[model samples]
Target: MAVLTVNDLCKTFGAGTARSNRVLDHISFDVRGQTFVSVVGPSGCGKSTLLNIISGVETHTSGDVSVTSDEGRPARLGYVFQDPRLLPWRTVRKNMLYVQDKDDDQARRRVSTYLDMVGLGQHGDFFPGQLSGGMQQRVGIARAFAVEPDLLIMDEPFSHLDAITARGLRAQLQDIWAQSRKTVVFVTHDVVEAVELSDRIIVLQPGGRIFEDIPIDLPRPRRQSDPAVATLQAEVLARLEKMKAITPQAATAV
Candidate 1:
């Protein structure tokens, strides 16, 4: 079932001027439930633009963004941003429930379960400022899960964390996704991160073209040092580097 469909997406900045730039051009993709899809591309290749479009945070100049379930129902969305984006004054627990309307027991139960799942049960009352960067991102993850969204969109949520912390969180995220059975679209710049965390990796080029949509068939609990995973990582990064070299500068010009 297609949980999200993006058709003919295009985005341009500063149109009809010297500074104009065509960031994303005619991009399209779809994702199904319980699948983890990661996107990688060179810097300034419009990865964040695509994510913003999917979340309806940014409107495209052309194309359609649709989120429908397996049964064609409207899919509920949860987004975890790169910045964590938690309210500074609110404690972790309160921030998680900021979007909820009722004191319904079900909401409370869901929030509690997610907080524990993210290993923040004991730190629910901690402010965002009091937590480390990784812990703050965990709170962001917990907040997303608290809503029980059908599709979760994460934009490099662990990019700023230490290497060891990022590795641990990647595995934790996989476990959470497995247990929750939610479709996730993750955006990142790290080749190894994409390989270790995604079932399929979509490589975007300078013109917003998908150069590669490689499926990682390696078994679960994939390690960064594993031979097969390492090979895939190298291959993907090489492909990305090659694309950067081959993309015509004219295509990006407005």
Candidate 2:
């Protein structure tokens, strides 16, 4: 299992003087095992920064953050960004292999398995450019899971796709997550998407503080058409609206 802990975490883009901009402020939370957590907020609200800090792509100004695997080792991480981020010259299979610790047969098989999970089994030999935008994102998702990471970080992975494509990919992701059960921290502005995918939703207000940490008690394989899922999504969206109404800073920050 994977364990993640954050205590009084803070991040500032500039440390001193008049130009200093603090993005995250004393954020604290913990996630354990295979939970899927979504961080939702408006743009520039430090959603991506939080993920970057957790993934070590960015540094925090102060506070404690720890991620560990059940085996008492540093947890392996997987990340899927807004774009595919694939090398143009590489085949899908090669791109998947690029991040693997090993190129052995077992590792290769694992890569293939994940590709299949994302419905890209036969496209492994194709270059990223050969695929459509949605297909490329599918490859990105497949590549992330191929690594068998203890923690997976996704930053608006489906944001760039068309609505129909995004919906399809979301369903695919839910199916894959149900089977793989990887610990995931997904960042999104879409409350409906958050409700569908997360075991818990963490709402980040402007100025980088958490407004609410709401648990999603809904069942797996959630669909927008499902009444329970829709109800929860509406409730979350309503809360976000109310938050914006009450927090004058949140309105200005957006």
Candidate 3:
């Protein structure tokens, strides 16, 4: 069964007014468990708005989003934002544990496991300020996974890292996804990053609607230089450029 469904979603700000803005337009998509889906678009394309709506952080002006298999169960929703957003004073372990109220030994064990999984077990005692940008982001990932979330939402989580670090983390994230099989929705502006990490790529245009949905159909541990990845990235990039060309100059003309 599909884990999440977004049906004919629409969101507008300042409706029926001179200053109104239509952010999302009839967006629809579905996500299954253990699948990595990336949404890519221009800077002001409402990508983050769509993700916020899905996470229940923001409400859509119209249409509906529904999640199956998550009605009464405690679902872990991991969010890796553009910034690590770690607590400055708290040690990595403490910052991670802050989100979990459960005291069961099982819970503690899971926390430790995710810490090690993200390569932060040895640095759990260190403060966020002491770690490198990439390492702090790793801590953020560990904190998110500590809850064992049913869904993971990443909004350009590695945009701040250097290219080498971003590439390495991409591989590590793929490993984590393979091991945990959590439902993942990764939002990125980088086409290569989206191709490397996702099982499917959903391109969002100026509006929140999906412009293209393409399955990767490539083997795991995909390399950036792989012919298939390069070709597919080129294709997606072309689509993005075309989208920009077609978008109207203003809402008045639409």
Candidate 4:
């Protein structure tokens, strides 16, 4: 049931050179099917670098990275970046349909379904320019879900949004994920958000090595307002702070 696996992963910039920088070193992890995993780390912990390597946007120096489909077919992927990255000229529906394998009734239905799930059913005809930042991000989320990727990669999708907007989107994301149950790998520096959204969290330390792999045992459909949820969030944040104190080289942002 392993959808994605990274074995002894290593990535270096200008390897073997005098000024070479080793970003990721001997990283390893496995993302099982239909589970939500979050990677949280300091500024230079190679969080995004690991994600890029998984998405094939960047190459790893040495490692095994594999994504497999259940039916023995090619594994498909979906990505939601910090920015919406929608075409300015394309309408909402058109933007969602852009990454689809083809234009067909099933695909059209999927687009409509996810748009409605993100509460943007009525804005299909609207251009990206017409929507607010939060709305555009919702469209991006919907587009990724519409594709129904085997593995979904999210890179701080709410990092650019205002606090209130980010909170609302986080809730929406939880609801959609509850129903779809897509395997997700989310990268963020926000410990509270990571605790709320992830079933298991992988903490990357200063050198791209895993500091901790914690499991979240809370109930689903979690909300920040919930007392139990808030308590766990506080605990996770405190642990990260302790990690920061121990490793003074790591940047603290929780």
Candidate 5:
């Protein structure tokens, strides 16, 4: 079943004014349950704006958007932004616990499970200020997964970190996603990262149009150094160059 549906969606900053800007143009896609879909485009292609609309932070100018839970209930969403956004005063465990609907044992167990998946189980009691930037991002990722959201929205979660750290987190994310298989809509400017993490990559054009919807059919637990992974990443970059409007960020380092 489709967890998220967007039909002919469009978002314009100033709908009626002369300085109108339409970020997303007739965008349409269906994210089925358990699928990892990535929206990869150059800067100013409305990647983040599309995410904001999907998460209800911004309203669409036209068309329809819907999110549905598998069990006929209200849909739940979890978000991981570029910044970790953890409270400095709270412990890692408490920071995660604060977002839960209940403080029961089941909730605690789920929090612990996701923390362990991100390799932060031992540091749960530590405050965010005590951890490094990478660890804090892990907490954010763990917190998002702990909620068991029907759809996970990630907006360039690794963009702030150094290249080495970003690569490590990508590997950990893939491992964790392998086990959880939560539906994810990840937005990134990196073709290499998109090819590594996504089951399908949705390339957006300069004016927020869907340029290409490509399926990634490689095996799980892929690494950046793997021959096949590198090959696919190169091929995707090659095709994106044909667009001519692909931003300089397309060659973002792996």
Candidate 6:
């Protein structure tokens, strides 16, 4: 099992200056093993910055943040960004192999397993340019899971694709997560996507404060077409709308 904790987190750019900007202000949350948590908010609400802080790509101005495996070891992390971010010169399989800590037979097998999971098994020999945009993103997802991270972080991994392609990839992602049961923290602006894919949804208001924390009690393998899923998504969206109404700054930011 893996655990992630964020306490009293604060991030400010150009702190203590006339032009300073504070993106996150005293945000905190905890996520346990096998839980799928989504952080959804409007633009400039620090969604991506929060992910960056958790992934160590950026530092927080003040707070305590930690990720640890069950045995008290540092948790292993994998990330899937908005874009594929693949190396154009490398083959798909070689790109998968790039981030792996080992080059042994077992590592190769793991890479192959994840590739097949994303329906990219037969295309591993191809280069990035040889695959469609969606296929390349699939390769990125496979590479993230191939490392078998204790905590997986995705920053709107499907937001760059066409609606049809995004829908397909979302389904594929749900299937893979159901099987692997990896602890995931996903960032997205889409309420429908959050309702369908998350165990809990955290809504961040402007200035990086939490407006609401919602639990999605629905079952797994949910579809956007399902009546129950649609109902929940609508309810969540309405709640977000209410948040915007209450916060004048948030409404302007959105």
In model 2, which runs have C-alpha deviations exceeding 4 angstroms?
Answer: 252-254
**Tens digit of per-residue lDDT, candidate 5, span 1-254:** 99999999999999899999988999999999999999998888899999989999998899999999988888999999999999899999999998888999999999999999999999999999999999999999999999999999999999999999999999999998999999999999899999999999999877789989999999988999899999999999888887764544344422
Q: What is the TM-score (0 to 1) of candidate 5? A: 0.96
Model 6 misplaced stretches (Cα beyond 4 Å): 252-254
Model 4: worst 10 consecutive residues (lDDT sum): 245-254
Evaluated against the true structure, the overall lDDT of model 6 is 0.92
What's the TM-score of each model vs. the native? 0.90, 0.97, 0.92, 0.98, 0.96, 0.97
Number of the top lDDT candidate: 4
* lDDT of model 5, residue 69: 97
Q: Give stretches of model 5 more than 4 Å off.
A: 245-254
CA lDDT, every prediction?
0.83, 0.91, 0.83, 0.93, 0.93, 0.92
Error of 5 at 178 (Å): 0.4
Pitting candidate 2 against candidate 5, the one with the higher lDDT is 5
Scored by Cα lDDT, where does model 1 land? 0.83
Order of candidate numbers by TM-score, starting with the best:
4, 6, 2, 5, 3, 1
Give stretches of model 4 more than 4 Å off: 251-254
Weakest ten-residue segment in model 3 by summed lDDT: 245-254
* Cα distance off (Å), candidate 3, residue 211: 1.1
TM-score preference between candidates 2 and 4, better one: 4
Clashes of 3: 1
Candidate 1 per-residue lDDT over residues 49-76, each given as its tens digit: 9998888888889889888766555667
The TM-score obtained by model 3 is 0.92
Report the lDDT of model 2 for residue 233: 86
* Candidate 2 residue-wise lDDT, 1-254, digit = tens: 33789899999987896889999999999998899999999888899899888999888999988898888776899999999999989999999999999999988999999999999999999999999999999999999999989899999999999999999999999999999999999999888899999999999998899999999999888998999998998889888888899777777543
